[model samples]
Structure formats: C-alpha cells, structure tokens
Target: MTIPGHDQSSYRLRLEWGPTGADAVRADYAVVVDVLSFTTTLSVAVERGIEVFPFRWRDARAAEHAMRHAATLAVGRFEALSRGDARHVSLSPASLAEVEGVERLVLPSPNGSSIAFALADAGSSVVGACLRNAAAVARWLAPRVADGASVVVVPAGERWYDDTLRPAAEDLWGAGAVLDALLHGLGVDAAASPEARLAIAAWRAADLPGDLLDCAGGRELSGAGFVADVEIAGQHDVSEVVPVLVGESFRDAATLPPDGPRLRRVGA
Candidate 1:
C-alpha cells in the first residue's frame, strides 16, 4: 500500500517519517532514525557486541518476550532504579554504555522501536541509524545502493501530549545525518528523492552539538535528567557499528561474513 503523492518512489533513495511514512516509501532497505535515544542506544549496544531486541512497548509482553529470548529486559528511566534492580538500563545511550555482562537486551520504545518493527514486518532489511554510526551505515549502504538497491530513511518522531506525531527536530537531524553521509560524505551515486535532499540539506546546514542540545528532544531528555544521552546523540561518526535487524534482533552488521549474510544461530 502506498500513499498517493507522498511516497517518494520515484527515486532510489528516499526519506520519510515514522511507520506510516515507511509504508508509503516502501524501499528495499529501511534505516530507522531516533537520535535522542533509540538508534543511539542501538549503536552502543551493537558496538558492545550485545544483541538488542526491539519491542514496541515496555509492558508485560516485553518482559515475557525477554524471558522467551533469554535476554535482559530494559526498563524506563527510573522504573528499574525505583525497583532497586541492579540492571538499570533505560533508553539512555549512557546507561547502555555503562552496562556490563549483558549479552542480549529487549528495548521497548514505542516511537523509534515501533517504527523499526513496522519496517521489519514489511520485509525491509532494517537497520537503526543515528548520528554516531551514520557514516558506517552509509558506507554499508553505498555498495548495495550502487548495485541498484533502494532505501528509505525513516525518522521516528516523538509523540505529542495528544498522542500525535511531533516530528521532533532531533530525529530530522538524525535522518539528515545519515543522508549527508550517504550523498556528500561517502559520495554514493544513489539518486535521492526530494524528501532525501531535504534531509541532506538539514544536516549540511546545521551547527551540530549546539543544535542537537537545543532541539526539543534534547531538552526533553535534559529535563528528565538524561542530558548525557542527548550529548551522546550530538556526536557524529564516532562508531563503525551498524545494527541490522535480522529475524527479531539488531546485530552488528560489520561482524557478519563478507557481503553480509546469516547472523549465526549456533547457540540453539
């Protein structure tokens, strides 16, 4: 199903927002962006060699899912803290960076994670993208796109008080960061749609670090005392890990065999 006039299907590279927008674009690969947290944390997890399971909600189902996978379930900012559980890792990238001995984790985030699930459900090869790993992700995609594959970068925006999409600035910048890396940074020959061009422009014209901290999502995280995570998001191209969703988990794509195939299932 495609949205008339909105789906950037005319171009090999496209950019959109959230799950609905992902459906509209419908590309071979989908890059999910959530700068303030989800993708940022995902990069850190993959960098640490931890498999991450993206769940849509942090509810009873998430806990059960984690148990079924024999993975640790991540809780909200203060939920695990209040419960006095030692494994207190939230969506914050900082929290995940400090964690140890965890091989697998279930990250339940409705916005970014939900969009990732939607894209995966639609059978697109999904990868989480943020400023930290944008260059690496772009490098991976460059060869594939040059070989005639298509891609859509989806910025998972935040929700408003009324539950509507807020089109958060941080997410836009994150998407733009990926686009910038692909087009100008890596010089990928993939033709970009207008939506994609907009993203590239946003990234090229931004002030960085300062712009990210002043964004709405940054302020929100800062107000919630997770300013460190926002600071982490402000960074650009510091990681080579690209977390690709294979089956149900996001694993480091760089670790796979040449040409990227089969995340090993030897444990089972």
Candidate 2:
C-alpha cells in the first residue's frame, strides 16, 4: 500500500518496464505484463481452467511449491521438449495448451514471476495481463480502483548480460495494450507518465500480429522452436480470463471478489 516517496500527483495509471520500475510505484494493484510468454502462458492456462502458482525461480523450491499445492511443475522449454509428453507444460504458451488432467501448475519465470512475487511480497494486489486478455483485464480492474487509488501496469522486461534491464518492445506493446483498454475503452480518469503515453501510442500504431512477430522477444521465441507460442501471444483481445493472484495462486478474475483484500507485508 506504500512505496517510499510515491508521488501520487504524477500518475494514477503508471507504466513501468522491469523490476526496478515496479519497485518505484506506489499502487493499490500491480498488473504485470510479460508477453514472451509468462503472462501469455497464464492467460492460456486460466482460459483452460488451470490454476497457476507463480514461483520466482525454476529450482527445488518451485518444485516443492507445486508439491505443496498438489500441482504439476511446469518446466523450461528445452526440458519440456526433451520429455515430449502431451501433459508436459512449460514456459511456452503452446505447450500449456496440450497439458491435461492437471488442475494446477507451478510456473517459474525470471522476469514475470519475479515481478509478480515482488508485488505480492510488497502486499499489493497483482493481476497478470497480456495481449490476449488486455481488454478483459481492464474491464475487471476499472471498477475496482477507488478514487485516488493508484494502479501500476508493469511490463516485465528481459535481463541483460550484466543483469540489468532491457526495454523489450513486446512488453511495451503488451503494457500499452492493457492501458489502451483501461484508459480509453473503459474511460478511467487516470494520469499517465510520458513513457506510458509513448507505450500507448506504440500499441495503437502496432499491426499486432505482424509487428509482434518481428519484435526481439517474439523472434527469440520463434528461433527457439516455439513459433506457435509467439503466434498465441500475438492474438489480441481474444481471451476473457483475467488471471488474478490471490493467496499465492492465480485464478480466474471472475471467481475472485470484485476488489480482493490487499496482502500484508511480511512481519507487519
């Protein structure tokens, strides 16, 4: 509920890319966008009625988290392909589509999961949004933000070799896609940063399917033999499921309260 030195006058619907940006915002809710393809994958799984629990790292802890919830562990793309089971899911959105008989899954990602975890750790409400369900997420959030209550749309960008952040075009577009629906479509009276306005402009100008396929994140997924995943991520405004994080698990936003309870900070 608080971020040190949070200037409420600056913006209501703020836009930020990367973990550091997320840390700078003081918001009632944090909507995370990671188009290549963590959030995209969540959108797909939520659509298919699978519960997703986000883990910050793909390690023993992640496996244990899944076990604790009686959920299956989603692996990395390379490992999933090596296993080659129809039920094997991973970071790839396409792979999740083929999985069956699993009601819940633990997905670990370097960017999206980490941001979601941080936001939850800070006791902020969290929602996962992407091109596929931007409009739905906007609709879900519009009525929930009370007057003067802030919301930050965070685009989880890729990490550079030196462990710094890289501004990803796909994430910008994804963040913008949600903002477009949230501000314009839903007609929320929210302020925006210059960077946010720029992102909104980019989203409006983008050809979506064509442009997303050419972006760095899209190309990387394609080159990794996950072309289908790229295509899945590019389908704009197609999904209705809004993945909301509640109690360490993501469920359909419709199943949650209109405005869910905020988390408490650790040891608070």
What TM-score would each prediction reach against the true structure?
A: 0.93, 0.92
Worst 10 residues of 2 by lDDT: 259-268
Give one digit per residue, the lDDT tens place, for model 1 in 83-149.
Answer: 7665687777888999999999999887888888776776678889999999999998888888777
Find the candidate with the highest TM-score and give its number.
1
> lDDT values of the candidates?
0.84, 0.83
Where is model 1 more than 4 Å wrong at Cα? 81-86, 261-268
TM-score of model 2 vs. true structure? 0.92
Each model's number of backbone clashes? 0, 0
Worst 10-residue lDDT window, candidate 1:
259-268
Task: Provide C-alpha RMSD values for all models, in order.
Answer: 4.1, 2.7
C-alpha positional error of residue 86 in candidate 2 after TM-score superposition, expressed in Å: 4.1
